[model samples]
Target: MKIHFSARTIAFALTSCLFIGACSDVLNSSKSEQLMTNPTEVNITSIDDLNALFDKYQYNDASWDKGNREVPRITFAGVDERWAEGSKSLPVEIKKMIFFRLMTPLALVSNENILREREIVKNSPLDAEKLKKIALKYDILENKTGNLDESMRTALLDRVDILPPSLALAQAAEESGWATSRFAQEGNAFFGQWDFSGNGMKPLNQREELGDYRVARFDSPLASVEAYMLNINSNSSYLKLRVLRSKLRAKDKAVTGIKLAGTLDNYSERGQDYIDGLRAMIRYNKLEQMDQAYLSDNKLIHLTTEK
Candidate 1:
């Protein structure tokens, strides 16, 4: 009435156990990785969460990227007298200056890929496609009038290559301290660019006191960003950078980061030191790792709900 197991069955069972143990996939579950992004990800599952994130974080590129891409979407349409159209994260230690809201996607393309592309393009000559691209950027030359208004449609377009969005964002972030500094809050200035035309918001705690002293201003953050780009495309100092970028594009050459950045000496009179700071910021923050979505002046993420 008692059951008995054979020696053969015992041996088979042991062997099976050993085999399964050796191939212990059951125990060895896939090693899943949890990737952590910069500035940390929060429980921003709603439009309200976005507003809270933007409010809590103050003005910074990280917040800008998160808000623009994740939540309600940063826009420049309606707002108070404050130049804030989108989200901003503050870094108060920085002086009163424009803080750039580094758009992730566009920044990545312009600063990283496009910069490299320029190099590749520079090695080559003016091809139909390349010319088309260059012309498109300089709409006046393209005669396309895609985004150019009537005023800018006739102006000469000089830049022939597209700056990688990342480089642009990186520069903006570095220069503006992640949209948290003083300039962005008061005047929507993000590029640390000075408009000597006696136009712009004056520093709140101006050391000079009572001067038509300069800064740029815009009704909307998008306008400020557009103006900043225009300033770059129009400025003389950036001419070299643009030329280098264009040459790199024309010849299909790789654009050197150092060389390209050299054109930003005017970005700060602190000279090479400023350049060093920017590079350091990019490296330290790994800001270059941000998404490269090109957030055009008019481009707004039309999202009313977060699903």
Candidate 2:
């Protein structure tokens, strides 16, 4: 029998699986006293220290395998106030590492799901029950219409597509100021994602014209990463990005961040300028290299949870 889970249930389960044991170990460590008081801050001294942590988990050298690459690690302690005080290079390095660690897995999972769904759709005769189940599972449609349509399929494809790492990292660095922005420090709001719901963190400078929208907050940097990806995937403004990615996938070409950056004109108020800036950042930082990186299966260095 095929199993199904609600979004909330799936989120809760994933969060629990990723953090429960990790948090417990952190709490039991020698630094537990300090961590209990400031849960968001972890003991990362320098970029070298962070790399050392990642090296422990890096089993394979992905230099040879172009197609089957994975990232060294996915967990990050997150940037704290100390990041702002650290060397200029430190913040940039931390931001880049954290961005890759977060985006790589999300992209991989989304790509895998999209590929699976496409295969299923291509082989099977349209079954309303199956299509409806998929549509509901992926949050493609908020309500079931009891009919499978081309629009629903398009929506599913769009929602299940991946965000290019270069675009994600550039936008993250720009929005969060290399993880030193107040929103990032306080609420793990890396993308400056706005939420009208009162559950989010109120922006200090929110203007009257901007309405009552507050920056969306998250329990961890990973959560912020997930939210950002989902925002791009599901939001109507980014439909062009999805369409572009689909074309690349059809031709078996790598979906690069530089190419996709052009379709992100709607991501910011600056419009075309924002897209240009994203492309510039990607090129300047050579972040396109990260598009090929993936996650490793080795043991991870877990950061303490944010309360």
Candidate 3:
């Protein structure tokens, strides 16, 4: 629950992308003009302030290269309510840019944590009991007492991997309306996950036949990203995606976002159309470039307050 961000080194760290100009050429050129903005270094009290900070750092596709895309380690402790309200008045392009910049680092950081867990699963001995605990945590373990076996290890490897940033970004945009949804603004629920439990925000238009289901909420945007990734990695609903990813890994093929996204037919009731929409968003925004991006090696900057 400790959402963190930093002010120190944030200005320079976020601007690091300005140095790398050799990334993918697949980036959308039509939106390139929206990337630049006058730099502003001030406390984030409004959506405009956050936009200025992103502008100052050049945190956009124009700065991210294909192989060498290193973004700053900037994170927000929480989304300011003002951002949700204020973004309504901003131009569509500016709002999109801010949404990308805000969500990108959170997704990368979540993926980084998952990758570390993956290493633990990958390197540990097959018989290690800790593997059972890990597998159980990821919802892949049914037997409580058994030596971890090859099959379990393979399953763990399959589920513990990192998700493509493009996929995550696309879903967040589609689900949360570019972080402008009430769930996103109030509950940090960026992925539109449902909760049957009582502890959730009831949807205004929820179908009565669906019971008292509400959107899952989180402590912060980063928490939302982490929960969404976990759901994709372990939920039975996304088994197809895990299978596809594992197949790509076995074949030694690069597991690009677009490729894995095809397996998400069950993600929404809209099925194939939902998948097509995600792909279109990814292509239109050139989100694939973000898959290659990484966090800088700077010291962690912890900002406790959004104000």
Candidate 4:
């Protein structure tokens, strides 16, 4: 004989199950939106053009220590859940991402003078130790590969977060050798990332796949920088970054680009070294000013296909 449970017990169990199933959706709706889409931003030709847009932004790396710091700005791309495997070709829609530097802030880059300052740089090229010590001592470059230093941060107080601008500029300056690298100039790629498909050009001694593929190219450095930042903020590889970002919004706190850098495992397979590399670039070059650049207000395009 089958034992029957009381009606109250059965009803309670069903209600609990329904609540558990809906909890995730309820909590997500209550939380601040982690993903967004923006239409007004800089007009770009390819992902690489984002570098120029970022370089024009102003960063104040020195202010990271101050309390009540302004939150860094962002432009949501509204990337719909879309992916394709083994396509071997980038879609024409991607041109929109390259064409419009969406993440560019609506501000002026006034910190270009800081990078040229003598105190921020090491006296001798070989004195990397001093720089490292100073950077480490303050935790200024720990994870924020694109953060600013003490001097620059002082100028950015009350100006807005603008930290992403710093990260973007630092990444470009360090990777492209201050816009002098061949890949930066020709291909508009600053990250030195390889495209496994044979569609794009490769650097000298660079390995090539048996087939053609594409590396997200841009018409300007700013466009490239913008795309690179967006990639880190959205891609699955940067799960930590996304999680940390979500946490900030959940608690009604501003997201810190430098802090978010710690979550970047997929930024490089080298793990912690990759984080260090990005931080070193930001610290050494004083890229904190890049976060100040604004958008161009041109119609932006979005990517439709992926490999």
What local distance difference test score does each model get? 0.43, 0.60, 0.70, 0.38
Candidates in order, TM-scores: namely: 0.49, 0.69, 0.78, 0.40
- lDDT tens readout by residue for model 3, 69-114: 7765555544545555555555566557656876787788788778
Maximum-lDDT candidate: 3
Per-residue accuracy of model 1 over 128-178 as CA lDDT, tens digit each? 454345445544343543443333322333342355444565666665555
Model 2 per-residue lDDT at 103: 46
Q: How many backbone clashes does candidate 1 have?
A: 51
RMSD of each: 20.1, 11.6, 10.5, 21.9
Q: Candidate 1: global Cα-lDDT? A: 0.43
TM-score between candidate 3 and the true structure: 0.78
lDDT tens digits, residue span 1-307, model 2: 0123243432332222223213221222233234333333233333343344444545223432334355543344345555544424333443455445544543443344445555554444555566666666667757766566677676676566667767777888899887668788778777999999888888777889988989998776666766787778777888898888888888999899999989988888899999889899999877787677654543344543333
The number of clashing residue pairs in model 2 is 4
lDDT (Cα, 0-100) at 94 in candidate 4: 32
Top-TM-score candidate index:
3
Q: Pairs clashing in candidate 2?
A: 70-294, 70-295, 71-294, 71-295
lDDT of 1 at 114: 34
**Lowest lDDT block of 10, candidate 4:** 18-27
